[model samples]
Target: MNKPIKAVSFAAAAVLAVTICTFLIIRQTHEDVLSKEAVIKKVEASYEGKVTKSTQSKDKKTYEMTLENPKGTYFLKADATSADILSMNRVKAMNPSVMTEKEAEHLALKRVPGTVKKRTHKNRVATYIIQKEDGKTYEVKVDMQTKTVLSADQISNKDQQKTPITKKEAKTIAERETGGTADDADLEESEGTLIFEVDVDLPDDKEATVKINAYTGKVANIVYED
Candidate 1:
């Protein structure tokens, strides 16, 4: 072929290859979009509250929404294309201190390697259920905020340890010491330590407050309110 004809032929071949690749890429992307749409529909159905507004950012490639009726806001990566209940709430709440799944898992292992009974997430915060060597079960709440441990408490096995005088044990001892009824009101954590806090209603028309260390199974503080 002549030089000009040869050049034309090469250009045509290049265009054909480019067109083919572009078609395949567009087709695959369309399939992915369909799959994501299905998942998003499922999320919307499962949500009890309403989504008020949805917006997409061109620069950041993020999809943000205002969830109303319940008063919430959410943000998601445009590429994620799917909404989860917890993610939606977390984004809406904009709680910068919330913990990620990985962060929570790492903290749990550090606290008690083999004693992690279960771990779950709600609204971006990680919750841990752990058991001590003494066969006591405690709920540990980690605040995603500040990446700190929030609270810890012993809800079961209050009678595991045998005290010399169980009935006469000091209120502080009962709250701090392992194997005693520490009210088990609720647990919170801070920094890296777990805190067990409880409020007890006594029969004598009085109330007691209790706190404990979840890691060492020791009581931290106790208070009586009449």
Candidate 2:
């Protein structure tokens, strides 16, 4: 009977030792991982914006941070242990008092009698691209808050050679490259080079702007909403 009691006690001691070792390993791992403050710092350094909110996943393996600046808002995800950026998104802000896209289009038409090709809103500014009846394309920017035209410039001449790529083709290329559909596409000229400016709607409620070269049908530059 004494031998059996001793055997039972030894088994219990082994089980307790294993449990304690497991707990210690987990605690050490947690200690080695980056802390919440450290992760926030990493995110701040990468995005240069004010952190508005921070949240951790239920599993405690990931963190989501919201950052804001004068340009727009950013949503970022980071790994809890490594503090590595998992994803980042940007969204443009819209003012309630701003004029609607249609209203801006009407105002642009009043200035130049042409068909509005595209209208985009960014940073409280509405840009309207119009193709005139004389076959010239013009870009007009309107201040949404003041309801005023900021600038209007002719981008294309009627006698200029036709572009190799169409606006629709440029939009498709922009969407494929960014993995987002374009909300607007405008043909504009920069330094004598014609390009298609496409606004893309990304996943996670974010926005992006892509510029495609009309001659090469390649992406010139892509920028997030911010």
Candidate 3:
């Protein structure tokens, strides 16, 4: 009797061990993430540009990719297993066509969740300023042609006031910073950061663009054209 019982116990232990190993193997297979090539192809099919850079997370659960097209440079995060888009945002944009007020308003509400109060357009981007009943103000920038949102920012009460720096002062600061001859500067505002973009002349027919803060007269950026 003891011999038979010992044999049955041994058989039960073997069966349990086999079941655990199979379960682990199945789980690992199910959790396997997609390859980098597969994720890139998935994004290219939906977006216009090819993936220029891709990085997988440490856990291999998601991929962050950078892509460039005529429209803009976009950053996208996608699920590694499902190849589903987790998030996408354009980091930079090229010139887009002018969008109408009606269209801009429609697009603005989708991101801002407020009633459109006023609209403005500059640099080929349309901005719809919205006001919520709670007295919160939001600014939404839309790419007029693509109808995609470039950014959505909330405006603090302090930003509603006029900027302190004058146009002439902005040009002077930009010229001083770049040490080049400045032309008429254009005042531009985004995400509550006001800037005066000045095109300046250098020697030998070269040109440089200088961007200065409109409020603080601080130099923001300068780019040289070859």
Candidate 4:
């Protein structure tokens, strides 16, 4: 073949290879990207809230989603083609509610049966942080306006010492010290120490609050009141 004709043939082959490679890359990307329906489902499944708004970026490579849960409004960004949550931020903190906190606490206690740590009302939602007698913690979300328990999730497992005394042991110690009937037991961690505060009903309308070290079965103090 002549020199000019051979050069033109080589150039044409190079162009064809580039085109084929580009086409394959595009096809692979399309196959890998999540579908519209799938992206929506992924967002809903991963987040515990209603997705109020979802839209793809101008480049169509990212999805911006707004979620509203019992906590507050959240802004999230997910990969357009993959089920990966890129970023999540609380954009707006819900305004605190004034009333219905006690009502919410009642509903949460009925569900989890624990001592109330704190109650927070946000955007008509009430969240109760409760700790059980065994040192396990839980978070209960309640709809404050409607006075309903939305969710009860255990946040932590029981933190029991390797050779710690049980509730019965604590109760026995308290009753022995006070010479009264043990009525209630509350286990809590204080300054890296597990303390069991037992309520004992004394005779003649008297009461005793006993604080005992759970690990050693030793009575820390006894507070007596009428």
lDDT tens digits, residue span 13-103, model 3: 9999999999997789556888999989989988878899999998678999998888899999999998999999999987866667677
lDDT over C-alpha atoms for residue 96 of model 1 = 60
Which segments of candidate 2 are over 4 A away from where they belong? 91-226
- Cα lDDT, all candidates: 0.56, 0.81, 0.81, 0.81
Per-residue error for 139 in candidate 3, Å, reads: 38
User: Poorest 10 consecutive residues of model 3 by lDDT?
Assistant: 156-165
For candidate 3, the TM-score is 0.33
> Which candidate do you rate higher for TM-score, 2 or 3?
2
Query: Candidates' TM-scores?
Result: 0.31, 0.39, 0.33, 0.44
Evaluated at residue 160, the lDDT of candidate 3 is 51
Which whole-number lDDT from 0 to 100 does residue 65 have in model 3? Answer: 96
Give per-residue CA lDDT, model 2, range 1-226, as digits (tens).
6999999999999999999999998888777777889988877787777888988898678889888865578788889998898998886673447787778778888887787666678987888777777656778998877788888888745533356678788889988999998888888777556688999999988999998877668788999974
lDDT of 1 by residue, 6-48 (tens): 9999999999999999999877655544244444455456654
The prediction achieving the highest TM-score against the true structure is 4
Better of 2 and 4 by TM-score: 4
- Give candidate 1's root-mean-square deviation (CA, Å): 17.7
Local lDDT at 110 for model 3: 80
Tell me the deviation in Å of residue 30 in model 1. Answer: 2.0
